[model samples]
Target chain A: MNSSSYYRNNIAAVYIDANALQLEPVQRAISKLTHVRPQTVTSVAEIPAAQRNLRTLYVTSFRGAALSACPGTRVHRCCNYHTVDLYAGCPLGCSYCIMQSYLERSAVTVYADPSPAITAIRAQALAAPEVPLRVGSGETGDSLLLDPLFEITRRYISELADLPNVHFEAKTKTDFVDHLLDLEPKGNAVIGFSVNARQFAVEEGASATLAQRLDAARRAARGGYRVAFHFDPMFRSGSSDGSPAAAAYRDVARRIAAAVDAGRIAWISLGTLRYTPALKAQIKRPYIHDEFVGCADGKFRYIQRERVALYRSVVAALQQYLCPQPPIYLCMESDTVWQRVFGWLPQQINELEALFAGAPLRGESV
Target chain B: MQMERVATLVQRVGPLDIFDQTRLPPDQLIRQGLTAVLALAPLHDSAAGATDAAEAQLLWGGPIVRRAAEIGVGELPARRLGPLGHRDALMLALRMEARAGGYSWSEREAIHRYAGEHRVALDTELSQLVTAAQTFAESMERYLALAPIWRRAVEAGAVDVRTAELCGALPPAVLDTVSGAGRRLSFSNRRLVLTWLSELCGRDGLHEPAAVELAQNVMQSADPLDALRRLRYPRLSAMEDRFAALQRRLTQGTPLELKAPPEFEGAGYEVQLTLRSRDDLARAIEALQRMQEESDELFELL
Candidate 1:
């Protein structure tokens, strides 16, 4: 099938590529977010046959910006909003890879084109020249994992160095800091990593181990790269009551303590494993099941009571490590989680703005 | 004074017990029901008009209503009496007589033409009207054959819940001035939930473990507001919040994912040279054009 089969959002038509037919049945399923039937055709020539009976929509990208409205994590992070999508899917098969289930197409697609994204960043920065443009590219896919393959980190440091106000955050799990050692480390850019404890990382995650991640963070910081850590998808596996939950929380707390220098951390994000019902089924699908994850609400894994305690314990543990206590942000979470974990829920914007401001700005406590 | 005359007219009419007629054969019922409805046309028209205009309209009416008037069908009753009472009465009578038994295709054609001639729209007023009517007729035929048995069952209190349900389609929800099911969600979602639950129970052969699992998943989602948040309809934010809250309640204990959904992929960039300086734009454009050309050449070789 032509490239369009991988992108169209709305329509009902089978996509078949001549080259694809001889291989494995493209194991990708249709995404409910976009109404489009997909079938991989054997021949590229038969692209017309696929299109003959149905509507095909053209799109440059399906997932939007990675970091859209910067919940200002660092005063130095882009003041304005920007996003970068470094890649589509990660090789590290985390069972809950949101993309694994959401993307209806099976193959991985990396945007080789970087100029348009850079131009867009430049335009957005210029639009709000005075305001810092908060932009990161690791949202759609792991930003740094593919960096070695494409020398992306090098490209970013060399090409995007001139735009002082345009802060670009490379959120990734791969260690490619050496590539950026020669380039002047701009205060605007921040390096982010999704991290978990060694045990959890070994059990549930497929990213770099805790030691590898800590080394990457230390090296990046030594090279003057502002670093941030995401305690996302925190595993809360014990029972709902006090001690089981406390143990899970303590383990997470201990991990965050040793991962990075407190002074160097730009911010720490606390996010629990939450998923939609559809993703829940995909989670239970025999091929993708993992025992480390437990259903909390229904489809959302991570036991509920355990999750709240975990969040509280992580934040508490981080307070001891951070000097000014690096500002904390919760990703895709409810106001209740914010209140239950951090004593208050910052305004839709303010709670996030604290991350970028270098301090938690006072917000109405709910 | 006028009410007594109307009652006398209804009593005199041959179609009064139309809803109760079960033994009439197919051809006979068709002939009788068709004739009765045709006969009542004039009375309905006259009754529908103002009291003063009733006589004039009846006198000048079309053939269908005129024939109805000749059969002693008087004015249709007042609207306060309800449409079901006046309009449905005659129709039910006709149904009891003419269509109580199955009709052949030709018989159906005759009925269709007759209904058209008298201005009756089938299958539209109530959903599945034609199918229901056919079922009702077949039931009537069966009842005629087993009237004594059915009567005995009724007398013995052996009529089941199924029979009571078949007495009529489910009654409309009671309208409460303050709050009710109607004010809560559209009937369609309610019906969807009901049908979904029914199918999950293996009623309509859709009793899949996955369906039940999905329902459970949606329910158990902690956010509780998750379902409404993802509604693709309406697009307005307010409606989304409302839908999310409702979905949360309906999907309690259901499994659902709470993550950023997946997205598709595309090429890296497109060049748009909109610099203020034409020279800058031209230079950038030239550079992009050259890069595109080179890439195309490289692609061709690959």
Candidate 2:
């Protein structure tokens, strides 16, 4: 893990929901991490508007079901992945983040408690033992970027260990796994890192560098946790020689192969850069000028052919460089893309065969 | 914030010609039929141009004054309030005019500019009055910030507010050239050309006439949209053109409508063949056979 903490030095203040102050872990985390005196507030409306951005911290309890399906982009194939919202905002200011468009407030918020989420997962995994539950904690925020400060995700990793068919992956763009290194039984856990080419790293804000993240992957794999990589929002460099984006992704693939045991890699996912209308207005980079066509889900992405080419190049690099191939899937892609890339769609359970013992019928989380 | 000012005193009425008509906001509809004139400064030439409405502080009746000028009607049959503080006068005028049915971008710009200069804080009121998708300050900054020519481009309905704002990011010289080119296009096509030009400038780090020059040089047809789209999406456009050419060659001007998905974003081409008799069926089959013979090339485009 890097020594300088983005969360620790950047957090200007902390506000906890009044009801949540009774939670034991909340007090412990504040004492260990928060430098400023924490404020107790009844609701977010009570906080000053100026203090509602990422510099301020808000610890509130999530009232909805903590565990839910990915709400996969409509008109795209469902990956059957489930997500848990341990936190709702990140300090790492990735330039293209879609969260910028929709989050009503910019403050980094912690859900304060993970007990209900863990309980729900245990019951579901036990009830549907045959279904592979590839649950993640990175839906609304980076899994490990803030995990070290709150130490909430480790509970899921530690408790879900005995569930044979379940994998609790904590995805992060940062190389912060040191705190969880000492847990005796790390469980059925995979430390997933969002990996991208160095060209794309410039816009990812204060996330750990590619080299630092690779080192973290090596550490996690050696620590007996299966690791995964997500090459999402891949860019196209518009050259046959592949000097910029595609070649750089291939180089990243080579670095991953060099960094960890390929057999220990649980999965990899690919997605081209896409932005909603709200996010499109916030972006002012050269990348905003890319040749993108609006998808059926109302998000703009690289035209289908361009995306297929990108996926093919990355998948080929991963297959060629790794001794034992890992399961690779397209994130939020349509059926046409699936057919074009993999020659068939996974129509039923276990059709992906190696990806999972596969997911159950539609609407069921993987 | 609802803007409601107490009814000010209307001391007198004079000839419409004496009241200095041109000093009013451009359209009375914008002022919702101005209730009164807050007479303040006296610069004699308020006859035909924007007199910096804020500095002049003259809120003349909108349509009535224009109608008076048009039909030779005498005297404004309207209220005439005395000079108050500059900000107070603006608040009174805005209160009377804020109930307009709808606001065009240009009208909103004028109202926002006047309100902003006065520091009258009509932002909350303006949000309720207009359907701008951005905050009042945001819209004002983006719209007010555009170069004058680009601003005119917006006023003429050549482009939308959001697209015009993007055009604002163009380097001054490049925007000049693009604005000229965009002037020759229809509203929708004008938007397309400008958007493509902005993106091209960003992609190649080219600015000035050069960025627009590159897109303009792609003009192989009378249609700037066609040429600019080709510039923006080269590979996709080429694929589309090639597929269209192939269909023309194979179908040979018959009613064999073969269409690919929009932007090649989907799979499988659609073939709509119209047939009436066996002879028509025979010709359709012949075209289908020809298509089948070249299916590899056709499907490659898809």
Candidate 3:
């Protein structure tokens, strides 16, 4: 690991709101990182607003309901998943982040209180014992980015330890897993990584390289944890018969196959770059080179034909690498694209949920 | 100080001997003394009279004092009145006294005309004052001329306080050029565009040091408003540019109108070819064939 490549490299300062000042995990996280003394602020409003380039860290209490349905719009096919917002922003400033426009606050604010969320997850699991519940912590932030500092995932794992029907996933782009290896492994827990083409991974300023992430996956698998990968926001760059995008996906799959057994993999998800209309103005000019056409769903996406082609190529590559192909799904896509790429669409949301529930390591209860 | 000398000259030319005699009441005597002084002073050159009273006083006093000194009055002080402050106060007092005794606007005009006929050499201060006032008046005229459009826009809700403030900061000449284009945008959108551009120019409510430098660059541009729009709505402008490029490429040989998805919201594109006759239809078909041959370029629009 590069000494300077920690997930918090871009954070210039860290502030702790008065309500969260006594949280031991937050304090320990601050002490572990080589940042300046955490200044105590009465509220997030007291901290000076940061520029787009400055990563200001805020440890504050989240007052809203901790666990909520994924706020997917009606125009897209949603996985009917729930999200626990452990944090609200990312230190890694990917160019196409919806949070750039969606979030009014520019700082990366970590919610100090997770008890309410854990309780909500427990209640949800107890209420729906007959059905599998998919809950993740990365809807609004990189779940593992601050794991080494706060050990948040450990708390989550402990909370959901006995829930056979509930699975907790923490998606991230970083390879920060030193703190997670020692935790008693639970089949209900998943550590997922957001993977991309090498061009995007380098250009997007992700904290971890592809090799580092694959290594993290291998270590996590060896440590008895189910691992998942997300090929989200895939971009179109080359026009040759075997495009750079196609080759990059094949290479990623090959690396992952070499690192972990196919049976240990939980799931793989593919999503092309799509953004809200408001984000068009917020996206920097250099990152606007991809071919994005406005779709009927009120977001800019690769045209239907292009998206179908890209997914088919990537799915084929994934199949070639693994002996038994892992269950793959599309994220925030329409039924038409799903049908075109996968040859059939799930008749209902639960049917799709069932597919995720049946994945090899994902289905192992207790 | 020059003003005091000019006042002395005015006393010499007047018929009243009140300053020497002083038989009347103190207030009356002071009033008579001022009348004598103002009687000789020209108060109304056409250009000077058009200016505000304060500015007119400065312009008239400079020439009158220089002329009185040049004419060699032995009773005149060795030095001009203490400084600009004392001189200005004394002049203001005399003018007030003259007005109290029924000095009409017509009388002031007559004095101004007389002063113009006996014009003295222009002093440095008086010349600068006149130049500055004239420049200000000219700008005021231009602003007034554009006020109707500004008022209409404000009334129509096309311009908000922030946008108006930004426009106000711009040079009058640039505002005049851009006002036509600005009027074309909807009220809310115009505000949105202007506010966005203002921030890019670093004038986000509080003035930043960099904004002045950026404003200079804006002033030097051939079309400042267009430059501002490009910076403010870059994605929209780029989309328009690409559409135009596509239209030019496809309409090379046919009367076809190509429409991309509204706001590029969808991947599908449409082409409309109008035909008035069989020949026109054939020509349209030929154009479509040509477009099909170079379909890769069309796909780039995605």
Instruction: Please report the candidate that would top lDDT against the real structure.
Output: 2
Off by over 4 Å in 3: A1-9, A50-54, A102-105, A238-244, A285-287, A348-366, B1-302
Question: Interface RMSD of candidate 2?
Answer: 1.6
lDDT of 2 at B210: 75
Enumerate the candidates' DockQ scores in order. Answer: 0.02, 0.45, 0.07
- Cα-based lDDT at residue B271, candidate 1: 29
TM-score of 1: 0.42
Best-matching candidate per TM-score: 2
Worst 10 residues of 2 chain A by lDDT: A355-364
Q: Identify the runs in model 1 with alpha carbons over 4 angstroms from their true place.
A: A1-82, A202-205, A238-259, A285-306, A347-366, B1-302
Cα lDDT of model 3 by residue, A1-366, tens digit: 443346446667788888887887787777776755678899778787453233677888767887997776546666657899897887676777888776645677788778889999899889979777889999998898877778778889877978887878988888887688888847578889888777666545656888888889888888888889999878765322324476777778788899988888878888988888677656643334344556655778865666788898988888899876677888877666776777676543343557444332211231
Stretches off by above 4 angstroms in model 2 are A1-4, A238-244, A348-366, B1-101, B104-126, B130-138, B144-157, B172-184, B212-221, B253-255
Better candidate number, 1 or 2, judged by TM-score: 2
Q: Native-vs-model 3 lDDT? A: 0.63
> Model 1 over residues A85-179: C-alpha lDDT tens digits?
65655545576666656653433334444565777777776786765565677765778754543455555555666777766778877565665
> lDDT tens digits, residues A1-366, model 2?
453456567788889998888776687668766467888999888779889888887898766887898867867776778899888888788888888877736678888788899899999999988878889999888898767777887788889999987889999999999888888697779999998888777788888999999999999999888999999778776333334477788899999999999998988888888888779878877777777887778888887877887788888999899878888888888878877877776553233563434434343354
The fnat score for candidate 1 comes to: 0.00
- lDDT: which is higher, 1 or 3? 3
